[model samples]
Target: MELKFKFAIASDLHIALPETVWDHPSRFHLVEFSIPALEVVLSHLAQLNLDFLLLPGDLTQHGEPDNHMWLTARLRQLPYPVYVIPGNHDVPTVESMDCFAPYYRQFGYKNPSRLYYDCEVLPGVHLIGLNSNQFDADDGQIGWIDRVQLDWLESVLSRVSKDKLVLVMVHHNILEHMPGQASNPLSKRYMLDNADRLCQLLHQANVKLVFTGHLHVQDIAYSDRFDLYDITTGSLVSYPHPYRVLTYERDRDAERLSIESYRVEAIPEQPNLQHFSREWMGDRSHLFMLNLLTKPPLNLPSAIASNLTPHLRYFWANIADGDAEFSFPNFPTNAKKYFEAFSDRPPADNNAILRL
Candidate 1:
């Protein structure tokens, strides 16, 4: 049997309405780059005749109700089905609002008011949706999969056959690139704090591939024991302006599951960070990501963050109109070393699929 579908993935669009809904000292402007950039990506995606659009998370800046409303209205106009989950910003950081449930109402399963939901994107392929954002009354927060969601997950997994293509979607990553994803002070402590528990759950069910955003850097993580891969894409508004498209198929006899990765190149004038470190080392705020070297796989810590921040902040202010890049040419070796270490997969003929 042959399974062929084309899908588009973009994250950290941080779409804003015409109004200035929220502000952070670090972000360029809510209404300026993100919304327009999303429009461009969506327009391009439509031309590709995509089967579906996987918006991993952060559909709006700060999870504003109006911004959420605006985005869905636009999504309704799209020609394909669009699936979404909430980024930390898509939920309220403040205790009162907790805006994520509303996003589920518009783009999630059965129109529920939870960030976690699932649906069938293809006849034999399943997309299990999840909501990873949760906070306590005392204002302490952790990215734990609550009991209700876990129950929901188990029930969904039970229905899948052993021979099926299952794509798990969520906003925060389970196995992040950096080691300190849970401990970093720079990221407002975003991540499924109990990601280990969630990983166990996925492993038990034989779920092998997960797609996530929110860290704003492109990297890959794999669980050797379970052979599960968690691939994170870079933000549209951040360095490299990266994105991805995946195509899955089985061998001629259908015993092996194979997948191919299409690394998104920046559109001629797309924006990329000379240093992903500079834009994210500190609390950049909701709608944008803190892609500091200190967080997760990089784990650069304070001294390095201090040193690199100077070089990074410049390009954020004035990236050129075309092919906006935030790379450090002066420090070539460091950059090369960074790329070699952080990538999810080594450079190869991407046209060939991996036998996962």
Candidate 2:
């Protein structure tokens, strides 16, 4: 039998709370427009009759307790079921470790206390949420599921019905969206170190589709047997902030899965934002560069790849921060070896080029 379900997927919400609860610069994400922009998006979303909404991660400006509380309260009021997983920002960073409860509470995961678990959001639609964010020195870097979680995952997959479609949700991409696996530092710590092993598990079980957001760009990737679609939804505080609605269905023959992606642009609604509304809208064209770099998944420089993350962040901030006449240094050579997979171009999207 064929099953059809429509779900709305958006990520990197980066919700900022009221000013009294924030600290400037430290509260770097409190841009002049995210909250109001989000309000418009959520209100608009209510008009869509979606079965559910999947927010992969980064629901808060940071791991701030109040931010989590405010975001969670808002989520609870959404019109449909909402599922979430914690992003590095939503989870505790060095600055604060107490934000997970409210963050998790707002997300409504299988078990907030547990890093990973499954939720059957609808009949025959199993939503498996994985906590791919964690440190494991034994793996030589940050991010990896522990032996315990890995074993549990294997066992869980064994029980899923092959007839049902599986939609995996996580903050990091299990498959490469572009090339340099170590390119972007923001995602380095959340990528599953044992990603290949995880792939084996999902593939063997016929997990045809997976959704993810991190890197804040939009792109897609596929394996013959299965496809991994990555949508790095723009941050609420950043320019070109976006969201999308996805529909998954079986081909007429019911022999394969067909997924369609639709991009949703930002809509702002705030009085304070009127001053910088034009600025907040950002350059749609620069987003092309971001799409290019993140196409394969921030496979930035693999070595000091994480270090170079700061470099990319600074460049964007300079431009987004309204500084003109800025100069960006050449892509660091140390970072060259990491982007080998993306070094060569295949075919540009002829139809999607910006008319610069």
For lDDT, the strongest prediction is 1
TM-score of each: 0.74, 0.70
CA deviation > 4 Å runs, candidate 1? 28-31, 93-106, 179-188, 253-352
Please, what is the whole-model Cα lDDT of each candidate in the order they appear?
A: 0.63, 0.57
RMSD of each: 6.3, 8.1
Candidate 1 contains a number of clashing pairs equal to 15
Candidate 2 residue 299 Cα shift, in angstroms, is: 17
Badly placed stretches (over 4 Å) of model 2 are 20-32, 94-107, 136-141, 183-190, 224-232, 255-356
Cα TM-score of candidate 2: 0.70
User: What is the lDDT, from 0 to 100, of the residue 319 in candidate 2?
Assistant: 29
The Cα RMSD in angstroms, rounded to one decimal, for candidate 2 relative to the true structure is 8.1
Error of 1 at 282 (Å): 13
* Residue 329 Cα positional deviation in candidate 1, in Å, after optimal superposition: 15
